[model samples]
Target: MKQIQTDFINKLGIGAFAYISISEFCGLFEYVFENILIIIKTEPKIIIWLPGIMSLILFTVIVIWGIKKFNKPIEIDTRKVLNSLIYLYFGILIAQYLFIYFGTDFLTEKYSAEFDFYNKANKGSLMLRGYLANIPILQFVVFGIILLKNRKTVANNV
Candidate 1:
């Protein structure tokens, strides 16, 4: 068992078992497992086959399939790839925030008669903000900062 696990992790290089892929795999697995457990304990019949769990499982399957079936890998170095991916994610988040801020008049307009779509749009934007705010992106950013700070420790250990 140990050998098999070690072999699996060893083979799970940056290609298929990239950080994001592994994170998705673990997240979906935990979500499905915990959700099923909670449902079984409480309301087993309720939401047994909800679209959310199904979609998460499907996404996990797709990630695994892409990693296993496709043998492609990073053309550049792993560190460079990681750096680029992190920067790309940061850029995407910034762009999304900009779009969400200025893309609509909900944030700027007064709640007058002309703002008929105010309530719904405002609620949706609030929900979106809450969802984004709850994500672990900040945690990852902190982890990166800590890792950079402890770079000398890692070099010494190596």
Candidate 2:
């Protein structure tokens, strides 16, 4: 039981860490790559990009660490780690959507100014937003079910 708990915690921690690292790296890359014209025009100080460079370095280190930890020939499968991460991220996104659907008024009351800005910035029909938000969840669920159903066959084949 303790070992199971430890494994669960490790999976969750690694999933979150990897997700954050990936997001930061991608965001920094997009900003730097897509805004090259604006950046050159502005002639901003080199220090302006220091944080992005640091984020990229951190992301590289995380990838190296993950590769080192998981590349060994062991019973632990990287696919399992990916499944856990997908489940976790989807679960969180679903919960957030639920909160937005049901608790918007309460949140607006509690965080009047900020919530108002958020709502305005994300202006869209609730029905459309709900459909868009649910599409990936549905796809993920279908993919997850297919993976789970074929897990044994996949393992045996491997």
List TM-scores for all candidates, in order: 0.31, 0.31
Candidate 2 Cα misplacement greater than 4 A, ranges: 1-21, 24-47, 77-79, 87-158
Report residue 144 deviation for candidate 1 (angstroms).
23
Predicted structure 1, TM vs. truth: 0.31
lDDT of 1 at 2: 83
lDDT of 2 by residue, 1-158 (tens): 98777776776676565565454443444344423423233323222343344444554555545555654546665456666766765665565556557655565576566544444544544554455444334434544554576566545643
Give the range where candidate 1 is weakest over 10 consecutive residues by summed lDDT: 42-51
On the 0 to 100 scale, the lDDT of residue 55 in model 1 is: 43
CA lDDT, candidate 1, residue 117: 33
C-alpha lDDT of candidate 2 relative to the true structure = 0.50
Clashing pairs in 2: none
Estimate every model's Cα lDDT from 0 to 1: 0.45, 0.50
